[model samples]
Target: MATQDTSTSTQLSPEALEGALAPLTAALGDRLLTPPADGFAETAAVFLGGPERIPVAVARVRTTDEVAAVVAVARDANLPLAVRSGGHSFARHGLADGGLVLDMRLMDGIEIDADAGVGHAQGGVLAGTYSTAAGEHGLATGFGDTGTVGITGLALGGGIGYLSRLHGLTADNLLGAEVVLADGRVVQANADENPDLFWALRGGGGNFGVVTRLDLRLRELPVVTGGMVAWPAEPGTLATVLATLAEAPEKLSGMVNVMTAPPLPMLPAEVHGKPIVMALVCFAGPASEAEAVFAPLRALGTVFDGVSEIPYPEMFVAGGPEGGASADARPGFLGEGVWAPDEAWAAAAIEAVSSAQHGLAVVNLRPMGGAIAGVDPAATAFAHRDAAWMVTVQGMALGLDGVPALREWVASTSGTLGVAGRGYVNFMANATPQDVSDAYPEATLARLREVKRAYDPTNLFAANHNVAP
Candidate 1:
């Protein structure tokens, strides 16, 4: 079990806190978790360990009514509010500092309307669960690579993944949402209803309210040719691959990384723990033409080739690690707007991760063009749709002791690459207030604040990537 980091915070009076939680306890029955309560420690767990702010109480709400009740209780008590879907926030928004956290795990449910080409998922739904459920109907919506991330948080911050090039962002696929506002009012936000709130929720992060359910538009995804091809870490190789991918068809989407290879069956054993540049890709349209389209990338180095035809869920197989036991968090940042790489930064990136003495370490490069750029800049709160690349330098730490060194390495590596300014909201890890502000353009931020003021006037949902009202 993860130990508490109570050193950083003052604990609330147990008697007063419990009294404040009485109504919630009565309403939620056994679902409310208080300190020393059964499953209390487990309720506070998040993907990345060592999170600060142990929640004063955790309410695992299953229904929309339960969500409203929890919100009302938190509001009445004037406690900080944390909204958790899949318990996968890199910033640990799932936990709170003497606050009430609404854990949405019990709400995981995915219902697909095939003929309508849409999927309505409860807040607790994870990417893997939703993908498998929707894939069964031969339909999909792009999300983060990992299967465990909550679709609600992922979509709210603008999800980028293997199918991003073809389908745009996860937020772009959002058709509607059931939201419990700060004052305990439940309403639906979409293009035709509460339109301004809908715009802010797309990429504005979870600053307005707790999203209980999401209506995502799904695309027909039958078969996709996807996998990785690696090369020894050669300077300019990643840039070449990115340039090629920038011009590649919309059906193909992937991520580039410089990592020390692991001894997996798909890769040769000799290359483990050595610098390498690898590209993981998915060609969603035609299986026959995937290899041909990937020819230029293979020629870059081609030490290992695992590309093959597979279902969309198979694309997530061995797709890096996050949450649960995979605590060797790879933390970094992507600056605002589109990036046309400087080429020299690729060398800096490869050199940076090569210095890691132990555990998983790498610099990631995710291409962000194709259909992502096709959206109007002001269309959604995810204002960086025009970015060509989202870059980050992440690596494993030797537990908490190595965090200082790991963070320093990441900072130096990113400084060399110059991916500064606003960052991707989902990638907002340990970001400063100014850094968070940079995530949106001026006009986008202004409009988002307007919506924030209107809905979350007192800013009860300030634990997320807060757009303060």
Candidate 2:
């Protein structure tokens, strides 16, 4: 559905592109799609949508061989190739402007080895699908907060979620991977084989290759005490909730977001559009003690409470924003710890939200410790193990016209909150080279670059958070 802008000099020559796609056409047949195809838009619709999110061509592959074939064709043509799993790239990197896209959705498959407590999942598996499969066996793996997020992307970028403190990051659970390298060679990566690539694959963005399948470590998590609870976002309410969460036990992991209440059916109509502090928490310990662990937060006077013992997968489908909303956000790690907000900090944040009268604004804070910090910083590609919190300054507008103002508000709010240094790569959008530099330390980046050189020296996989050779 996305037509090339012929007027832009940056546009690829349509005739040349068509010629380059000939090999894939012969190989994939009807599985390959170009613009204006009946199902192209549906196949390319990722988390964020627009003309930019549409690629010149899409290849829907059902098997690893097909993926390798497509990758070989793309490399031979020297065409930029984007890979799509759950299609949630914050910067829309999953779709290429004038290149081919490898649609991995059809490859979705999960085989849970309950006896060994491991999950063998294809790269295309979504968080919810994997969780549901694992939940059947009283086992689970930590992905991000969203059900639709790709397990491969989340794990590769250091996934943090409700069970993060209990089970560690999703990357921490990754035991091995089947990667298709730049040269079209399919190889395995893990502690025992290709250890360097295996280390890079963990918490390293999609830089080295296209992962075909992953071996993830699962935890025993049949049911957890988890759900959303909220309080009116009065002045300093954000600060109080954050401080409380920071002091809570490691078994209790909370993701707190400050935003104006929407007109959801469960919420009282009177509170609609009013600022509120909402938190989604999970207690992995005894269900009976969930009440005690959350007592400190409940004492803050909750306006709504939905916390209860439930199936692990249920947490992903709980109340959330409607799909298709466009967000302008800045992600950062606050190594200094929770916001020790003064009166000024609270006022600035409140005003930032108020300015988005017709849109949506959110300040999300997730404290870090426990199993996440227990891992050595240099153990994997995710080096920010000592960070105290993960923060995102986000604003969602209804239309494109409101995005610019929202971006300004996000910048201003981020400055006020003092969000500095490297951020969680998964949350970064429209990141610059400087941003990439911030995401990794000098030693880690140097090592990653060396690996990039060894495997993908030509940089065939440059669409993701790139570590150039």
Candidate 3:
């Protein structure tokens, strides 16, 4: 549980306020957002849904200098600060209770150096934006599945996506990062420059500093073949699919979703409200080659097959809901490698899906192998290099009253899958220290702690999956 400071009334000195706002307003011009400003509430509402928190101020910084100025003010005033890029954080960590909320959404800039095969993305760029820009140049970088996910948060937390099996985790492609330390000092971290900080930022989960920009290595990705295939959800189907997926070629990557079929126009009407397995897939090779690769899956008797040759940008379209008040979700990593499946695991998954009373219960299984598994576990802060799949159980009800029951059902169902200890940072709702520790090995945790001490000695950036300084 998070300890809250319950003192009702707290104030900052007038001089501190003047000192903080003066230079920030001057440097950012009209980007600074005070409580009374237009769009202040909307800016605060971007990344949050369950609880409403009104910050003292929301500073929409456009550049690194503005970020430094905002940090300096927060430091001088002794106020907690929240950093937000795309504002899609699952735990609402991007919104401060009563402190400053630093909005980085205005910094969406992408520069791709095709000759060098590298791309520089500003903090606010979403995964979709970056992918589209890179696709124009016949280049690509690994990012999370969702288009709305910020590059800053996803890269820092070990990005797993369709391309992960072919290229690598997003952190693995990270060449460098421009970060503003807790003390408002701007620094560049990479293999040769501030190497320790660079290692920690890879999978450290935004604890060391606020990343202003990222330099990512790009891959040659002009076109790829991928999409979703939906099948009737039966008792033994899930187990059979998992067993087959474990043996599929690493060139083909995908995710399996067990959920109540939505009333979408593309889905067959008979499948609505019925249990279904929607497997989102991606292949990095040519269309003909991909067709050959996916032929085995096509033989599985899917109700609807939308899989075909498509542009890489279409991959982000597979992600589900971004913001809503009536959803309860828990993202976790399964521990066991791709071993033989059992009836128990399949039974639990079916029961969870069948027992969903209110709205929908989904078991999302994302494939993990190829380049992601090839990287050494010690190379970056993302320690789960060997896990076979990342699973998330989500239930969305009609009202707030259903939140507890939904959350409880998700927890209980996840436990029955037999791999509940490891948790994914991006999917974490409101996790404890034990949950965070379980995500990484002992050695990785120790190194992360040392790096945290060096970058944020006072633990000022303690919002997301914090590594205590």
Candidate 4:
């Protein structure tokens, strides 16, 4: 299991902090946010909640050269380094508890070469931020389902979003990347250049280096029929939706979410706490043909239908309870992939959500197929390419007080489904060392370690879903 970051209570050694400060402040100048600075708190705040980390300093880099310079400073000082892009890691792995954190937030730039249909984006960009901007060009790159997730983590770890089936995982669409290695060397990886590192970067977590920017293949996504449709909890209904989505056209991708309805404006007030099953889908084909494609879904006793022909970025629309804050929050996440779903599996899904003892609980069945499976499993570091159903069980509470029960629930539920060992790199929250290793196949793991040794032999960037050298 991952341990706590003690940087919160213990201050950095003044000499070491001072050592890193001079060159960093000189290179970054006013962009550096150190302790006692007015914006330090705001600069360090991550998504969900507090990382509880008070790093010696946070260097907000606006250029790739600056990223290289800050990296050299940390390297020369022998200080551990962390890379912060969007700060949306559920594990908050974006922050190095006590080390210098390179803030990539200011490098948020998106340039779409419409002629080439390629998107070159900075590491600090958010999924939603990029999606919105890409939508303006009637183009987009697949990312995590949420708008706020950082593109760097989401893409590097293997993004499964609304466009997953239509295109493929975010990493599959990546054409190239510019990475800063442990030795302060900046290199570009692509199909023809540094192919080994390029292979590792696609679906391999941020273990090799600090990625400052990425070049991704953009898709022509002018519109999509996407939204949520909910129903009162029923095992049969759940089975039908999962099966239907599995057999649906490649252009249609979605998630089957089972949980108590949150008090959203559209949902009836009385239904706030009632158990329900919701299917959120996006059809990337012609907008006019979406109704026909989703005809059968409406027949499943729909309680709410918000599907519409909205802009591509609208797929990131969100509602429901605000999850617990990052700090003081202990959440257990277990993910598995199944070939099919049955009534029993659906009932178990419902049970998983309702059994949470505290905070919030969610059970999601992300249907995978189409373009996601078209790529050879061995082509990228991601290996779970064939599973039709990816089941994720999540439980969150206020503190460590609720962790034991949450772990027990996840363990029992995952075991019951007979998928106890499967792991999705992106969604495996609060993961252990073994869990990180298990995210890839045996062969892939060996190759990743080899690449790890080559690029980051000492594992200088060890603050993510780490791949040990």
Candidate-wise lDDT, in order: 0.79, 0.81, 0.79, 0.78
Candidates, ranked, TM-score: 2, 3, 4, 1
Model 4: which ten-residue window has the lowest total lDDT? 327-336
After superposition, candidate 4 runs with Cα above 4 Å error: 1-12, 319-323, 326-339, 398-404
Q: For residues 295-373, write the lDDT of model 2, one tens digit per residue.
A: 8788888888899899989999984455444555678887543334554665666666766654678888788877888
lDDT of 3: 0.79
Candidate 1 local lDDT, 169-271, one digit each (tens): 8998899999999888899999999999999999988898889889999998888998888887877786787678777888888888888877767777778
Error of 2 at 65 (Å): 1.0
Q: Which digits, one per residue and each the tens of the lDDT, describe model 4 over residues 1-469?
A: 4542313332446876786678877888879888779988788776654336667778899988888888787777766677888777777776666678888988899998888999899988988889898889999898867887789888888888888887999999999999989887889999998999999998888888888889999989888888888887888988888778888888888887788787778877777877788778889966688877888888988888888888878878664235454322222222223345788978987876777666556677788878888898888998777877666776655565665676676666666665546577777666778777767889999999999999999877777878889
Between 1 and 3, whose TM-score is larger? 3
lDDT of 4 at 466: 80
User: Distance (Å) between predicted and true CA of 284, model 4?
Assistant: 0.5
TM-score of each prediction: 0.93, 0.94, 0.94, 0.93
lDDT of 2 at 134: 96
The residue-level lDDT of candidate 3 at 3 comes to 26
Clashes of each: 3, 0, 0, 1
